[model samples]
Target: MKKLTSIIAIATSMATAEVANAQSQYYKKAEQNPYTLVYDGAITKNEKGKVNIHPVKYKLNGIEIAANVYTPANYDASKNYPAVAVAHPNGGIKEQTAGLYAQRLAEAGYITIAADAAYQGASGGEPRHTDKPQFRTEDIRGMADYITQYPGVDAKRLGVLGICGGGGYTLKAAQGDKRFKAVATLSMFNSGEVRRNGFQNSQLNTVQDRLKQASDARAQEAAGGEVKFSGVANITDEEIAKTSTDLYREGYEYYYRTHAHPNSTFLYTTSSLLDLMTWDAAEHMDLIEQPLLMMAGSKSDTKYMTDEAFPKAIHAKNKELFLIDGATHIQTYWKPEYVVQAVNKLVSFYKTNL
Candidate 1:
């Protein structure tokens, strides 16, 4: 018995040391990439008398939202300027692609804001990572409310750009929120369609079973039991290398490897699935009467989602779907050449519409 106890103690100490080492590694990397902003053109802090990044905090639906607002070069509060709101992707914060786009737009002379989702990132919310369709849509609307009131902003010329899951929610928000004079989506991802039907319908037969699991998770949370989390908690290098789909394989690489951000995570409460599985990105597409542009990678496995949603927006005043050649969904977020191409198209789209 004494020998067994000693062996267990040794094993426990080794495990504890390993965990401590992993944390130290994360913190060390974090110092090099503090703020977790990994985009090519990301800013470390706000600069004076130039295109600058302004960290913002505001209340939306009673939750304090964390965001970054980019002001145009030589900004003058006395003069009116056009504004745009850039929404981040799933498991994304303002510091990633959204901030990259926002900063690029600012250089193009448009004030822009990129915010973290309420229950995610640096934003304030209970039961962290509770992603619901309603809350996501509301977040887009909240950006409009705050930016329109910002000094030098012209509410009449406001526009919105949603990326990935943000793109999906933007479609829902723009369907009713006419305040957004122009709408654009980059690498659009339909959270609802994928959740309910599964990716490429690969898990169609297990829908009910997965749903029951979500329901049970919700019940447990309501009863004040142990909190349950879902989604990708951790992954091995070998597993990512062997992933079949480009959308996810490259995605795991982007979100967990090359451009990994400490604030970005793959987990969400299991109960969130209850709401996510029932929503559809294109349910009310007819209401978006504003000018619209949807861009995605032609080769993306998730391109089907954009293809499916774009055509349904027939009521939009002006709508165009452009597919990037030779790029994948995750590539559009960080690839220098692809990002430049997207920003150029966006500048043209916004200039013509806003």
Candidate 2:
């Protein structure tokens, strides 16, 4: 009787542990499906174009992030092709700048996948726009996994390109992950440094201001609602400083209006500011073994990030930094001339490296 009682207790304990594990897994899946934004309609590929666009879904950090695959015109399922994964800027969608870059790269004879980061755009995640650096970095790695397994994609020749904040994440991914043979960034924002210190370290000089802002944000969050975020919306004459070294106003105009999508907005959580404070994408630049390319608009305020990050890359014997004189940060997003220049550079870089 004593032996039977002991056996029954052990069995019950084991069953309880299994039940707990199952619940944990279920909650994780729930976290991944916290939210989603569906596109009103599909974006069709141009018949005359050499690229075909297809919607795809993949899990990143357990979240089901959505992406679009652009296959070269002559894509043969039996023949593997080098793949490029494009990451979009902060608060931007896959359909914005990243999509354009991916499509162009695909047209240039590469398989490209442009993805919406977790918690933003059409991707799935809780709290809507939480910007976690580690998670964002994981998103890129997840894309590499998705593409390598994809039909017609040559895993060994995988490449990554990131625009704006996406660029920062790409750098982080390349530094940590060996899957990406080549990595590149356009107008990369050192999110962690920028968050801790304002653009150009202007705001970081004093800790009091940052503390106060964080305190207020926490209070707002505790009040049972989402925290609000602020950023450049529509550009105005008054917003442009007379002695400003960068063409920030013009850049905002290009991104916020000319090429803006209804689903894309600059709103993020005030809590995200805290995350950015510690998020440094170029922390281990010297460790990345892959080829690196950093491109920036000489006239943009965000040029400092690219400038600082490029010189620190140690393992990359092959690295290039191209500065476009007349372009501003936003102009590089979708301006006809600047976009053409960027796409050309990207295609050239990937072709040479891959």
Q: After aligning candidate 1 to the native by TM-score, how far in Å is the CA of 41 from where it should be?
A: 2.5
Question: Model 1 over residues 273-301: C-alpha lDDT tens digits?
Answer: 89999999988888889999999987777
lDDT of 2 by residue, 1-354 (tens): 112111001122122443334334433422442122112122343454456787889777678989988899877879989999998887788877787788788879999998888888788997777787877888888889899998999899999999998999999899879889989899898878876766677665554455466567768888986665544323333333332534344544333434445446555665666677766877888988898889998777888899889988977957999987688888788677888888888888898899
Against the true structure, candidate 2 has what lDDT? 0.73
Best by lDDT: 1
lDDT score for candidate 1 against the true structure: 0.84
Candidate 2, residue 74: Cα displacement in angstroms equals: 1.8
Runs with alpha carbons beyond 4 Å of true place in candidate 1: 1-30, 33-35
Q: What is the lDDT of residue 215 in candidate 1?
A: 90
